[model samples]
Target chain A: MIEKQINQKAWFMVLPVFLLVAFSAIIPLMTVVNYSVQDTFGNNQFFWVGMDWFRELIHSERFHDAFLRQIMFSGIILSIEIPLGIVIALAMPKEGWGVPVCLISMALPLLIPWNVVGTIWQIFGRVDIGLLGHSLAALGIDYNYTQEPIAAWLTIIAMDVWHWTSLVVLLSYAGLCSIPDAYYQAAKIDGASRLSVFRYIQLPKMQRVLLIAVLLRFMDSFMIYTEPFVITGGGPGNSTTFMSIDLVKMAIGQFDLGPAAAMSLIYFLVILLLCWIFYTIMSNVGEESSNGGV
Target chain B: MTFNWMAWTTPTATFFIVIFCMLVGMTIWEIKCPGGAPRQSILHFETTRGDRLFVSLLGSAYIHIIWLALFASLSLWWAFAIACVYALCVFRWV
Candidate 1:
């Protein structure tokens, strides 16, 4: 075996990333961990609560409901956005000036602040000055998102889809663009139909990007707060109260720091677990496909 | 209940119309030129036009989000200003 040289200087190059992550993620995470195990009252007085907060959170029905809502919201959006994005990506022009124009348009929604998106929808869904609400009302549908749970759910889902599907589209489009012209030429020579070509070639080529898109969408949706908070304020009655919103209501709104911190830890763990599972499964699928081809 | 097409606000209508124009422009552009060649920019990575657009948009979004979070009470115009500068840097380097 050949001897490989290890460079200590490379450590300096990576130190910035490590420092940034520690400051932004690790330190705050540790603070939450510290808070999770201790009960605190005014003036920063604290008592060791041990596992009490976690135990209570795990048993709480409100926590469970919010968790379920978070899960359900992520599920609904991923199912819709992934396929919808793929279809839109397929329809998009693959080259030239069209490439930049299409990409920029798709990315426009993603560039807007989350709260602004919620505010836009909030006004857009108002029965008085809103376009959608007024149109729905004029069509003889008694649509009121504020008062109706189903309507609220629908509106939030629509808003999320509108906000995020572009990410999927952009990812898929990038994946599509990476496919060589030779692949299409080969498909033509094989007399493969459009659908078969897409299924065999395009979908397989897109798997890695699709995996990234899915994981990103999952984590973001799971941690969703600002947009829905602006729109519904977690109610007409707590109908749109997802996990993050609930956690905020507990920690900041109610000053229940211990329980909120515990809940946040659990929430973080769930996202990590799900993302790991997704990564493993998708990567294994990728490996299997390459092996089968060989 | 009667439907009134004119009830749509100018901002909302303008939003959709701009999106429509973009789609139309893209279609016309594709008809004119069929493919993009990847080019090396100031950024080390080779990028196509689409990639550059994506990087700019994503970077701008992060800048805006961070700005909003840091200065919640302040006017957002500064964020827009910074985003414009960020976009320019991305287009130039990335």
Candidate 2:
């Protein structure tokens, strides 16, 4: 048994992050809350209109549609990126000079700024000048992201996958690399098949990183605005208008501050609730699996 | 017509070229001394040099993204400054 020194001075190191979060997150959040329950007109005049904007936003069909679209986009992205990332990670070279080569190349897309990604895709999908557009047209494919809703969705999804799959790959690769060589040597002694080895050893080792990857991907994709906004400007006719774009349009574009503020709160709560649920469930599953494996 | 290389703008070409050079450099470094052994850090899990780079780059991207989302009209220099700080922290701790 050892006695630990409890020093309150340790909290000093944490103070910076706390202060940063307060300024960046809490202050803005409080401002939004203040705006949400109030009405303002012209020269700094304001009136309390408690819950009116919240009621309006909840009853709005536009909010529901955008919310559903956001959900669908995240769902589709996860389904594609997770499996694709894992497969890429598995196929990647595990040793020698190839390891860094593979990792750096895979990470290239992720390092590009989001708006630049949007611009690249936008240019790459142009009908007259873009490579992809030209080739597809030459091949007799009716691919126009600006004209068709399905085309717009597909392009956005593809763009998201291209931009983000590297993140999942890197996380999965880290997880894979963490497994001790002894585990593989034992499996070899048992004459375990490749699939079985992956199933038992690699998959279990990957559980923690995969949880992190999924959560980060989910939150990022759910809040995604820049790329899609730059690409289609929420599309030809609100076909691809996600929640973030819609919120910005309402608040900044239309200056409906009250409604936008209320909507922001609702959106924030939904994401927070969903993330908590995902975290609890995944951690519980991880614990049970480890226990059972032991 | 043969491929028109000029269609690619300066920034786009430069981005890809830089990434290519970095990849080549990393490959040479790895070949000279293959080093991926995980070492203990401030974080609970062991991490290699490559992991540190990933964490730094990813965290910086997040900093920029958050700044862009919150303050769209402003120049990104402030975001870049903040991201630099974030990168330093990730390199030190994560």
Candidate 3:
């Protein structure tokens, strides 16, 4: 029998994390919670409203519309990105000079700042000068993101795919790279089909990374603000107004601190809840796979 | 120390204090009874006490919001009552 040794001094190493979380997350969260129940009319004066903002926000059509749009955007991006990333990862070369080329190219999009990516896409989707818009127009498509709701959505989706799919790609590629050659050699010897290889060998290995990729993509897309803000400013008649963008508009544009704070709380709650659901469901799937092994 | 940066109202302050107390209590409870022996609940997923607590808290938030949305003129004490029942059901079954 082995007696496990515990270190008392090891607790010191964890103090910094708690301190950081307290300052960064807990303090600001407490502030937001304070603001959510209070109304202000400037000069640092505030009055208690007692859940009035949360009540109002729950019934607000604008909030509902923005939330639905956010959900739709997240769903669309996840559906596209996850599969596309896996496919790209599968296609990537295992050896030779192409490996670095593929890895670097896949990484380049992620390296760009979010706002800069937005600006680049905003220009890239212009009807007059930009390549994508011009090419679409030249090909006889009615393509004006500024004018058309559908066009704006299409542009945003394309921009998001171009910018963030690389993250999924890189994660999946790493997952793929982790597989031992012995597994592949055995599969080949066993006369396994490519589809069988993917279904059995590749996918199971990629599960954890894909879970991470899915959660990251879901959260990022759900809280999408900068790109759409830069590109459309939540325009084309509130077509691209995600929850975060709308929250910003409420907080800064209208100076409705209470409602904005309430909205922020709700928005954060929704993200937290959805992420938890994703984690639970995915882990359940993992557990089932492990238990059954079929 | 001084805490003047935020304009804290009683209800809001109580709200945070309650959350903080619940967290501390949960930590103590976890230390006292390790693992909590994850169980497959009515939701058809395995969850420990912490997971159930999170689900309950999140559910209570939605319940309160919905109650406020629907019954604006009514006293909020009833909503709180309903949330308590919801939490009980979660802890008992889920």
DockQ, every prediction: 0.01, 0.01, 0.74
Error of 2 at A204 (Å): 1.2
RMSD of each: 20.3, 17.6, 1.6
Which ranking of candidates, highest TM-score first? 3, 2, 1
- In candidate 2, stretches whose alpha carbon ends up further than 4 angstroms from where it belongs are B1-94
Model 3 interface CAPRI class: medium
Sorted into a CAPRI-style docking class, model 2 comes out as incorrect
- CA error at residue A244 for candidate 1, angstroms: 0.3
lDDT per model vs. reference: 0.82, 0.82, 0.90
Tell me the tens digit of each residue's lDDT in model 3 across B1-94.
Answer: 7676687878878888898899999989988887875898998988899988888899998888788889988988888899999999999999
Following a full C-alpha superposition, what root-mean-square deviation does model 1 have from the true structure? Answer: 20.3
User: By descending DockQ, how would the candidates be arranged?
Assistant: 3, 2, 1
Per-residue lDDT over A1-294 for candidate 2, one digit per residue giving the tens place of the 0 to 100 score: 899885769789999998999889965776676677677663555567755676667667999899999999999999999999999999998899999999999999999999999999998887798888888899999999899999889989989999999999999999999998999999999999999998888888898999999999999999999999999999879989999999999998988887898889788877876785677567767877798973
Question: How is the predicted docking of candidate 1 categorized under the CAPRI scheme?
Answer: incorrect
Candidate 3: list runs displaced more than 4 Å: none
- iRMSD per prediction, in order: 20.0, 18.7, 1.2
**TM-score of only chain B in every candidate structure:** 0.63, 0.67, 0.93
Model 1 over residues A221-266: C-alpha lDDT tens digits? 9899998999999887989999999999999999998899888878
